[model samples]
Target: MRSRQFGPRVSKDGVSFRLWAPAAKRVDLLLDRALPMQRRDDGWHAVDVPGLTAGSRYKFRIDNELEVPDPGSDFQPDDVTGPSEVIDHGAYAWRAKDWRGRPWQDAVFLESHVGTFTHEGTYRAMIDKLDHLVETGITALELMPLADFAGRRNWGYDGVLLYAPDSAYGRPDDLRALIDEAHLRGLMVFLDVVYNHFGPEGNYLGHYAPEFFTAAHTPWGSAIDYRVPQVRAFAIENALHWLADYRFDGLRFDAVNHIFGVRDEIPLLHELSAAVGDLATETGRHIHLVLENGDNRASMLDSAEDPPRGKFRAQWNDDYHHVWHVMLTGESAGYYGDYQDDPRGDLARALSSGFVYQGKRAAFWGGEPRGEPSGHLAPSAFVNFLQNHDQIGNRALGDRLESIAAPAAVAAALAVTLLAPTVPMLFMGEEWGSRRPFPFFCDFQGGLADAVRKGRRIEYEWAYSKYGDEVPDPLAVETFKSAVIDWEARNQSPGKERLALVRGLLAVRHKEIAPRLPGATFGEARAGADGLLTADWIMGDGTRLHLIANLSASELSPPRTRPAGKPIWGGALTDRLLPWSVLWSLGEV
Candidate 1:
């Protein structure tokens, strides 16, 4: 029988194995027999185990004191910290042979937690929901973090085991099955990965080796030492493993602001981007890397050369969501304070420039000014959303946009998100106006769980005391259960109406705007001094579209330059649009 490739398959004759051990002076790869790998000039230890079969189990001995799992392990069955299992990437029976990658611009993201997206909360159960998403016109699905986390019921963000797929969600093969099934249905899958920091529980990196982290402290705890050569190799190799082994089309990086590397250097962001790009070229597959940066830094859109654009395909535009939310809900606590007054200009700027805080001082951030995005980047480079896992789950009660705003306001926001220049995304329940509250919940056991519960309650109570209203306790089982979407509700009249409206808006976008895709031009119209704004898109084929919004409480007159042809949407042109109403129209200018 032919021997299988043991590590990353580079070419027919070459494969690479990497391990992360910063503190160790010497490291050896323990293959079928103990083999001392030669330390490379670049700080990685490697050996070509070409004759070794794919199912071989291996570990690493570092400085004669620690035997740790492979940092780039393809499989880890004996707990997350044990020895790794080498598997042939080509062995899995893939059913998605004709799978073509879904573009970031083509995606309508469905963000949901595996624990609550269905009653079973397993990968298999999620596979059953693919038909619904496919029919709903979503081309891609963004799953919340699913790395092996402690306990069974917590959100996947607190995940500690980066190598092991959560056993609770069914084994590694199960996740592969989920991706394969999704691809078969013409839906791309993007996994939300937490790289800036690991979760609090089952995190055995410290126990095995000190090289996994650095002296720097992050909000989540110790930061990964990306500046260290071995540490960088480990991070990059793990990302490659996910794409090559599991066939994930893309990765949505969580909290990239915390990824601090060497100053005056390319930084890990650019390094990973280049690495992923190289791998994509070799594999002939379209792979995307997205960043979620709270800091509105324009440098993220830079290319590989010069100032070095952060090397990411796209980054989440929080400013757009912040402006939209504040305008509709009229809430100004916390981060919303920066967008409290005259948010129409901010919204219009976000639609035109892709960043609302461009060179503007943020009030909530205390004199910190955000930079503008490079004008050359396409509209798809900015991922805009009014609701996401963070925006909903981080709230005191996890109230969705529909919970806090009127139905008309919610519909307007949806239209704006879908029709704007930036790529649009929708949170799971937002489409049907689901009443569920996606509150924060975890399954930490014993003292840890109790501490989390107490801490969450204290935090919500403090918000209630200051904000003038009590919020729901996050620890309550009812809170988490309430977040489970009522799939049956989609059949009802109100739910169907909301879904149809979204469908209509998306139909207009896909048919009219998206066909123009990267070359569409944008301009904005102001409705007097009250901050009511309208944005227009002129397609490559001379087709004109307009988005008219009334951000203020009262209606405003149309802009001075009215379209010459009949309005495609009559509801938007009617007099006196109530507070927070938005309309989309197609006509000739």
Candidate 2:
């Protein structure tokens, strides 16, 4: 029953319009013609128009100079640069009205980009594939950001209208149907939201309310001034709107490390979590929140408590991915350089603790101490993955690990990641080992388009020198099409084999590990110089989950003592582990 403060308020009586524009001297509500709005002392513009109902389109005129869509617009039918259409949030008749959500422990995430998920690339198109996910054992679908951006083919990160679900996909109802269908199938849908910074184009807040941003800049754009009370309310309300309006089961906050304040204060992240926790309590829904923070601040995660109240459920464990990548592909560019020296050892640490850094001095992080002690947190506090959008798209060729590394190695890595007690995620087509590339693509025009092209080339100068224009263009239609996963591959040769492997791993995870995840505690892990890895975790039911892996391409002799548990995966204990071999077992304590 909470009302949004920034957008049109619809009721049986009429619609009340409100805009927070302190910088603008005068504001006009644009329907058929401009109507002057009454300016409040609190720097808010208000106007009431009776009989203005849903399906009506409107915009705001600032000082009779520039007209802009509502920053809180429900739907941008004409994209981010056009007029906003009024939408009734309560109008949708959800079929799964009784559905609350699944527990965090049951989550096996499939992170996807809606635009490139299918050949049709629409919300309705995605629904047809929900059964595929269910059969593949993906209990949760984590979508990339859906906020309206300037172009038709963005990764959804350049969202300018925080409230509008990009019209390029489909209508608001269509998106609702996707969630509704997903819930009916017992799949929890979580949205990836960007609160750190707005996209470069189609953001009109600065024209009327310059105070919304600080002079400080993030890598994308100006840092939002969350210090302001109105600015703070805007973000919190946006989070609620998605959860309440569309009935999303949870949210994954993107790169929250960039959401910094000029002065030290209570973080907006905490406030947002508290608000969401209150909603979960009121609705009795098991809503979850995850963060993609580079800082690795273990203090923020608390998966120890059931239904995780008043804290984040988990964080994306980039450390786990980095070590695996270095060991597999031998690529040490960028952040990968940090793990190159002791990748096996780092992998051991990641298995034993939630973070590989854990307050250790990171050579890649400007030689500064990174991360906090996290061995005490529950094993589920980390979301482990082999690949995600950023790891793939940010590469020069956007090559998947299966494409660049040996298939056997990637499979071994998956065997370790998927069966572990920590929450596991998969990139869109990772289960089937689809070779389709997910190169970065956007639909910007003119100067902005050119800037994107040049920036990519500059960032990948080595690729530019060698490939020389063969590198995928971020603005090209072909680039977007190339990222569309080949669904047919799931039924083919090696794809079929890989699919079966993942399906079996997830089956075991849900059957054995999930029930015991509640009291799962971190156990010790050690990697020998001869490519032998020994790790274990104490499950909730007092069972010890054990793992032994030979990450190297050369076969290695086994440790003196065999794992105690009955074999869950891999064959019986052997004298030697073959190249890229892994073993998982659960033992009675």
Candidate 3:
């Protein structure tokens, strides 16, 4: 559905163009030559140039005037300002046709941002580190959004060209190569996509069809009008485009809670989820659909019997992170306020159900009722992570967990994230505990750049009053440079130690806990005096895994000595857990 039917369809010898501008009286194909298009039965304008070749740049002239990049452009090599290039979607020769993708349950995601993941910060350069990721036991690579924005560096939430890969990361084929390499090496790759709003700069969608957006405003920008047939088609087309054209296994939709003013039903989100299911069935590929919705709506992943056609594979479990963050850092700020009291129960709820809120009134929701009941959901439905791009990068200093919490505390959290019956995601360089600070950085030049800088300064003023001006300006090049990972650190002493910890934990998980994930999981969590949280998971197969974690800075009660239980990872834990520490034992009688 990508290039074969939509966008600029490049055949053996010519280029055919199509546009869906019901508002436009006339739209022409403008490139090496201007060609008038005929209005189709479906209200789409279409024209074909018999001898036009690939690599030529083109754009659509709307209403005999304003030229904008194609809404489904494959390659915007010259970025947003220039013409969109013609590229055949079937051009690349893929080497991993046999790569059927790993099972969804075996997914251990390593969330990476291409711009800061490596010094080169290109798709090709990212491919070079795939082996390191495989060694770290990451079965799937989850990239931050790669959609073309206005400039070189961004967190990628602000994307304008939904169909075009960011040119800063390299050409279209470069991205295809990275995916192909990952597949060949027994790793699956997925992309993060922003569907709620478009970027402020270089957005040309509204110029052609103003009806593409609505009066509703999201936190980032203008909300899309899903009720409009063309708008819904535009979004759904973009989703299938990434899968069909780019071979992306699936997508992580950013902030569906901001997609619309929610009332009763999420029609567009459900429709997109169903569409993904259809695509997977059609292609015979294992596709996954994940959401980062703040509202833990159970309907998002319900069985096919339910309304709204719930079929998503998983969602980002922020409840898990919130509980751990407050416990480990004693932070009662912002959203953390919701979990400050009796956090151990919340953690237990996060473990038992996939969501902590579960239709309860949350303090973070201004003491309002939020989050649907999700207690019936499977544990694997939650994507749990201790250090994701948001948890670290949203801070005043963009500090990782290592900076704010003790090593023992960090390890305790990692143990839960890795060993529990949940989908675990590791942020880039997390295994080696890289010190690179992933601050919010964007190259929104001129007025927008000044606005971002000023806005960041004002937003973090309270933090500055308390912690000083150590918060790097989001618009600076230095901030972007500072975030790039130093690949050499993985071999160093401390880095190697962290790496070994992760490797051993994952090894144990694959050997012991993985088999139990498919079976019934019975878990019990208890909060003791002196900042201690104890959790035990007994599987249907009679394999029991116990965790005693101390989130405090000082040591708690002593632990009992291990007789014959295998200790595969992390630090020691006897009767009492060490301060900020956890102990895991297998086959304990």
Candidate 4:
């Protein structure tokens, strides 16, 4: 049980390094050292290299056989597997002095991966693209996880080091610059973080601290031991560090269900939420916590007689997206089997009630019934999206919904998602209908790379056995490369049309509906025999809006007696709504 601290320290010439390896008979500073050296007492080994500056690559040579990279390496250009580099995180001059924070309820989030977002695959490169997002009416940006992982090229879910940002995206300062630039443009940034499990390769937390991981296993690897005092502190402290130091507006927790603790009374989620709230108050900035819970549990937001509600601002409503996807595409395979035929009913239920599975058995889950979200929760409490990284990447060929469905249907889905009762999110290039396939790919060292390939194949094989010939190998480099968005596509006719539709929908939502409701009361739609569904939404301020959606492919005019005298902002009568399309209008009679 020995502790080792290796990092850049203040020195006249630069910095010095010291490590602890009591078990080893010998230790040496591998930076510019041709030979190994002996260890000292007090379980400490020291080395002073004045000329070795930050970004210097180094490793530790222990017992002559083990040559490991610096445990605190700031950059790993060669591979995710090797040693670390010395980096002074404090060296960067931050420029986001005037930035406060964006409120979660009002945010329009855009999710993107750093590697594919730009050709350079650096944070600086992403900073240059912020203007496009800002102009597109997006209020916030959600970056995919960048925690230190096994390779320079990865989706980042396989991150092994929780505290370190991926060096492939440039140094810590580069990230700071990106965030600062985004803030300057009035865009709040939310980082995706994984706390459920660590990737298999380059995971050395167990070696550094046995309590860092628990015996309980996850699909990825060992589950973090939140029950242990040290482990609890580590998780909380790591979260606080990102917010306090990096100035990130919020965090999107990867898979919170797996963050299990033995104690029933004090769940790890409660503790994490409390910590985030305290930090937010102390910093005088609003910080949001979002969860990616597939279980559809309502208690996730409930903090009754407990610590502050699991500091989560919202959770992804997968049921809503799944139902919408199924209805639009009419595909029934994998988990979507249950969602095939009856989409209108499920969608209507999800809109009026927060949970679509309320008291209904989940055929795929093989469960009794899932609980519904409390009435107290606002529509903003749910983050809705038609497609995300997983939905696209998990496909056999990693085809996005836009690619599978007709252009008109895709446009209609976007309109429906934007007008829905939840906060809307769009994956990169989704608004413009980018045809790129977001495939699952990895770059790991040695035999680990092959293992990742095999694992991905097995998962997709089982999921898409019906389309055996269509399935693309997840390990193929081309599969991952093809996922990158083509910047040139933004100017095309179809892209422009799709972008305009999204802009129109968002403008209506923000300008007319959002201001009126603040928090509106949702009413179920009563469809006519002609196949038009109509609902009445009354705002908190008594402003009433009558919405009529034509869900069929053929155009059918509503009766002349249908709530007349209301100044219609827009509507589609002769304009046929390709099956699955929706039309929303706002005004008072």
Best by lDDT: 2
The alpha-carbon deviation from the true structure for residue 56 of candidate 3, after best TM-score superposition, in angstroms, is: 1.7
Q: Tell me the number of clashing residue pairs for each predicted model.
A: 1, 0, 10, 4
Task: Candidate 4: list runs displaced more than 4 Å.
Answer: 1-78, 262-266, 302-309, 466-470, 516-518, 525-531, 536-540, 557-569, 572-581, 587-589
- How many backbone clashes are present in model 2? 0
Candidate 2 lDDT over residue span 482-588, tens digit each: 99999999999899999999999999988988999988999999998778999999999999998988988898988888878788888777988899899989998
Better of 1 and 3 by TM-score: 3
Clashing pairs in 2: none
lDDT for predicted candidate 2 compared with the true structure: 0.90
For candidate 4, the per-residue lDDT at 168 reads 79
lDDT of each: 0.71, 0.90, 0.79, 0.71
lDDT tens digits, residue span 249-368, model 3: 878989888886445464677777777776676677777888898888776764212111346778899999999888878888778888988787788778766788887788767788
Q: Quote each prediction's TM-score.
A: 0.85, 0.98, 0.92, 0.85
Model 1 CA lDDT for position 415: 73
Residue pairs in collision within model 1: 302-309
lDDT of 1 by residue, 1-589 (tens): 1121223333355445665444466878777677777775545566776656665677888777778776455556665556677656666798898675765556677877888888788889999989978777777788888777656666678866565677667767888899999999888888888888877766656754577688887666788877765567556666766776788887888887777653335367777777777767666677777778777666665322211123776778898899888877888877888887667767777777677777788876677775565445666678889889878877877778887887777777787788775778888866777877787877666777787766665654533455333555455666667778788777797899988877777777776667666555555545445746777766555666787777556667655555554454436465555566776677765
Give the Cα error of residue 346 in candidate 2, in Å.
Answer: 0.2
In model 3, the Cα lDDT at residue 105 comes to 65
- Candidates 2 and 4 compared: the better one by lDDT is 2
Per-residue lDDT, model 3, residue 534, is 63
The candidates, ranked best first by TM-score, are 2, 3, 4, 1
Residue 447 of model 3, lDDT score: 84
Model 4 worst lDDT window (10 residues): 302-311
Give the CA lDDT, 0 to 100, for residue 289 in model 4. Answer: 81
